[model samples]
Target: MKKSITILFCVLLSIPSFAQKTEIIVIGNIHQPVPNYNSDTILTILKSIKPDFLLQEIDSSFFNDDFTFKNPPKENEGLASVQYIHNNPKTKMRPFDFEGRNEYRKINGFNPTEGLAIKLLDSLYKKNKLTKSEAAIYKKYNDLLEPLKIAASKDAKSFNNSSNDKICEERQYYQYHKLLSIMQERSEFSNTYYTKANGEKISYLKGFQLASEFWDLRNQTMAKNILHIAEENPGKRIVVLTGFMHRYFIVRELQKQTENNTNIIIREFYN
Candidate 1:
């Protein structure tokens, strides 16, 4: 028994830590104009990198073996990358994004569009369904976001030096991360998502709370999924291609995780 135990211990010690052995690179992607960055450029870059697995931002629940119900279409950056991999007979590609089915599942069935939700709430306030205070608070919270939204819209409209035209990760980070940070700092807006109205608590933040939670839960899930996959397949190279908007949260969370898990090396695509 002692001899057998010693052999098992030796095997265990020979195995390397997950972090020290694996390479995880997170790349930001552009969505519109299918070939804007130009598919050839994207493909060439990916070919050289040669990732073992490509983790995408898209939800996987939409795809089938037939590829008939493709979620975003092949022109989208994420799908375009997939198309490139398929053309290469030598490359082995595995899909990591499940079409956000996980995010959809985590939401507990509350499906409300951001614009629609806000519009409905505004109408409710108009109809007196919401108290004056609730309406006023809601307005105040949204008012804070108006400036950022306007700035983003204006930046996009210019069609010049707009990250929207390209992944342009650095520019996107510097410009938008602060807005998201501000949103996070104002915890007051989330104080009571819904208040009691006629014995039923109504969500005062309306869809705002749901949307915030959705992104948070989604980012957290993505991080957990990446870590879990890495641990299961030690030394595997994984590249996560997500929309630039998610870069701030995903990178932040992944870096924090690395403090405890020193074995894996997390690298930015730019680096």
Candidate 2:
């Protein structure tokens, strides 16, 4: 029995240790009438990279929804986009699958447009019926965002570059994340998330404080997701397409996971 146990132990020890391998690529601002050149450029780049998996910033839940609905025409544009890509012979040459980072899921929850946060906020307001002050505050928040909304509606490119546009959108993004962070911190619900700062809370009473905290936290979450994915998929190459600001964070996270090993490659696609 002792001899047999020793042999089994040796075999188990020799089974080869696994190390996850992944590559992270960042794509910045790919919207517009910049002609087909930009898309073609991206197509060429993707072809050369030939990544096994293609993770987008889009919410995975949405992707699952598209899959469930058999690519319904109106409800989901992303699915159509994916189908378009996959059907093309030249660009669709690889067996890439769609996945999303934690950031995408988290943001999807917060989006004031057709997301959980807006629904909850509406419910809460309706339940309490919102005191005049509370209603006023909410209205103010909406009003603050109106200018950017109009700008975005008129000319997307101009709005994308406008300082107010960034502030307004980032404000919404931060608030959304902060709300999630608060929920997570409070440990009340599962879908509601807190920011990366672990125990931080977002108090609705204090207009934008929570959002500011959570915005930074989103950066951390993005980094964590990138690193976690890389570590979990040892020896397999994975690619992530996220916001440009996240590129450095993902690279740093990967470096830490690899123990400063220089084997990991990093590239940026932007102006």
Candidate 3:
């Protein structure tokens, strides 16, 4: 009888350990105008293990954007879309937005975070590694960005009587160079190919290069602030929503941290 009792006690002690295992779940999906999280196979997968946090690819602006919910269907709404779900205590889910131009600008810099892609590629350009095709691509990028630069420069001048240092660095590096190099380093991949006004084919490297630049820093400082919040809320589960591409990079990097064995859960959606 004593032997049986001892076995039962050991089983009871092990139950909590099994329950406490830190989980790192990664999800991937495409962006849809109307998010499809409800019908996703991952719904059952996620419901089985309720997380403490939900990380999103979006900037924190959503919290204050005051945008009305325009959900696709009743059953497939997110905590953010489903007004009632966000208010539930049993789920204990909280929204965590990344810093950016849209909102939290004072802390994270620009919104759309996509803006960083240009600066990152410009850094490579300053290194004399950008090719002729890449140079043309840069021109297009500039064209797409001219309006933003004008606005940012104006804002910086008004705010500090000078351009932002970070903004200036990007401008200097991206300024036209006399000679351009063409090497297929991961930094110079093409995104869209188009002929220039001169009828020469542009490398379309800007988009891919910008994306590479983002991935290079995603683990470094881009996600640093978010990680801090995650660390502060110990024992709290989190869900981070973010660009589909970034989902993979963020999860992999978190797994590398030594200070805490954080159990990450990743879910990707296409909308």
Candidate 4:
């Protein structure tokens, strides 16, 4: 009878572990204040969530020994997160951005390719040389972005919803995947060369490919960091504060982990 009671007690003790789920909220945030969404808006959202952990979109290397930003940006969501942590002393703030990201961008000359691609596209458009299909794709991409741009200018909540997330994903699809496809179809765009800082002449297509890879890798690393924290904490609530553009990628990656039986429940701030 004593053995039976001991077994029952052990089962009771383990019930909470099985019953509790790790809740994760991914918030799409703006770096600078818009018409309605400012630092106060971000701070309010953080307080409402009351998260046990706040995963900020800041590289770990950027933090000083005292947990403040060594070289802070003019204005960003991370600053608001610091404010939240100050008020809620129990909530832990962590940096989930990819380390050495700046170094990678500098070494790879990531910005030149995109700038050149846009210039080529603009030249094509101005000269009426763009194929009908290419023009249509660009128009659709811009149209999709218009709503986001409008929402960002006025309504903070509208800009951060699932609708906007889907729009952003579509925008990325056209911008990265579809645009690359178009660029590769024409030798004019693909074969164009840009001189890197290191004096190496790389094709525009290759440079864009490298930039896309880096973007994906950075998001993957950030998602992995969030997942690790969720697994370690088990039932704790974690809020991921990231730029609106990165929300889709991080959420997609986290969803993949959920499919593999990770005990995480992803939620939006509104939900």
Candidate 5:
């Protein structure tokens, strides 16, 4: 009996013990205040989640040494987070946006127009610059995505849900990855030149590719920051509030972390 007891103790000591998994909810937020999905709506979500740490999509430089906004964040998520932190003094808010984000954007002359490649294609078609085949491709992509956009825009709640998250993911994937490739393959956009927001002229293909790469890098950085927070505070709940456009990228990146660590769980706001 004593020998058996000693062997069992040794076996127990050799086994690795796992820490409690940290719960992370990545909530998709709207930048501007919509009818139902305004600051108040986000505030309510923060209240319900009651996260120990709130990972905001705010650039580090945007915060003061004490973590208060330096010049007041422009996004609705930032606004709501401020109010939540005021109420829940214990909950900490951390900026997780990519460092040098503004400078990079400025240097790259990055503008929102880069994301409107589809709209640009449609304009080209209307202007009779694109061939019939190119026009048909644009029309097909637009028709498929328009209803989803319409449905998401109808209400703020509808826009932030998982359904909208999926739509946003699909839309971005097609916009940045598939659409450009299809157009190039069809020889539709090869000769096109797009004037960037900063008035620099570049091929439509290169401009979209650069924008896509930057977007992926930014989301990857955000995910890395969130993972660091989760690892440091084991078993705590962390809520990531970011624009709906970034929700899919950040969540997908975090999900990859779960596979190796097994100490992180990615969840949706509704879940």
Candidate 6:
């Protein structure tokens, strides 16, 4: 009887926990549709990883095939990969990102956040609201940014069967952030307060700040949504496909989350 008790105790200790261990894979991606990378590449890898749920950097509420037609990178690598996964009858689709421009609009309360700085500044220029020198500086900065944007667009294969999340994190860490820094520095409108033709003074910094807040808040919301997914679907293997810029912050947030009833395993997808 003592020997039996010992065997049973050992078996009990070896059994996996009932709460379920959740595996989360976050992939950083380039937004452009580079021809070298295609649906087959993504599909093959995802087929192996076999996630129970796949998340995207799209508005939670936005429905099928509507906005992509309006956007240039619509059929880009990220969305294409998502579409391939979602199209498979086997993969479950989950909404991850907050509502797009509307999310920012709601937060700022009577201000625009969706690239409004560039638009407003350009509009002001067309209407002769900005000085020639101001417009020139903005244009110059945009010109300087073209090369960086192209480099990021071409980095579609940064993630593959061999690399982990950290590899992707580091790759994008340089390219994406360098673009952001250039963008911010070029936003001279942020500091220079100018009067409209109507005599009301406006600062482009207001728009820049609101836009920045929108992005930061969106990231936080995304992390919270992941936590909710963990609680609702315990033991699920989830893969998040978002812009490379988001990888580091989301990974940091997920690391900070600790749950008693669920075990979380974070990794980069590997075949």
TM-score of each: 0.57, 0.42, 0.42, 0.88, 0.80, 0.60
Consecutive 10-residue window with the lowest summed lDDT within model 2: 89-98
Clashes of each: 16, 10, 31, 0, 0, 0
Off by over 4 Å in 4: 1-19, 260-262
Pick the TM-score winner: 4
**Backbone clashes in model 5, listed as residue pairs:** none
Winner on lDDT between 4 and 6 is 4
Best by lDDT: 4
- Model 5 has how many clashing residue pairs? 0
Query: Per-residue lDDT tens digits of candidate 1, residues 1-271?
Result: 9999999888877776522368887765544543234445456657767776666665545556643236545644565566666765444434455345545533532333334345655665578766555656555555554443333343222222223323333333322343233333444333434423234443324345455556667777788777777777677777776655565567677878877775687875545
**Candidate 3 wrong stretches, greater than 4 Å:** 1-24, 33-42, 65-88, 92-98, 101-212, 218-222, 259-271
* Alpha carbon lDDT at 128, candidate 5: 79
Weakest lDDT window of 10 consecutive positions for candidate 5: 109-118
Using lDDT as the measure, name the better of candidate 3 and candidate 6: 6
- Sorting all predicted structures by TM-score, with the top scorer first, yields 4, 5, 6, 1, 2, 3
Tens digits of per-residue lDDT, candidate 6, 48-72, equal: 7778777767764554553222232
Please provide, for model 3 over 1-271, each residue's C-alpha lDDT reduced to its tens digit, 9 standing for 90 to 100: 9999999888876774333433333343333433323324335434544655544444444444443233332322253323333444344333334345333321232222234434556776678666667767666546644543444333212211123323333442343221122324443334434443445444434433333444345434535645665656544555444433344345546656533553433222220
Error of 3 at 185 (Å): 11
List model 4 lDDT by residue over 73-134, tens digit each. Answer: 45658767778878888888778888877777767876677768867876776788879998
Off by over 4 Å in 5: 1-20, 110-120, 154-157, 160-162, 182-204
Q: Candidate 6's error at 81, in angstroms?
A: 6.1
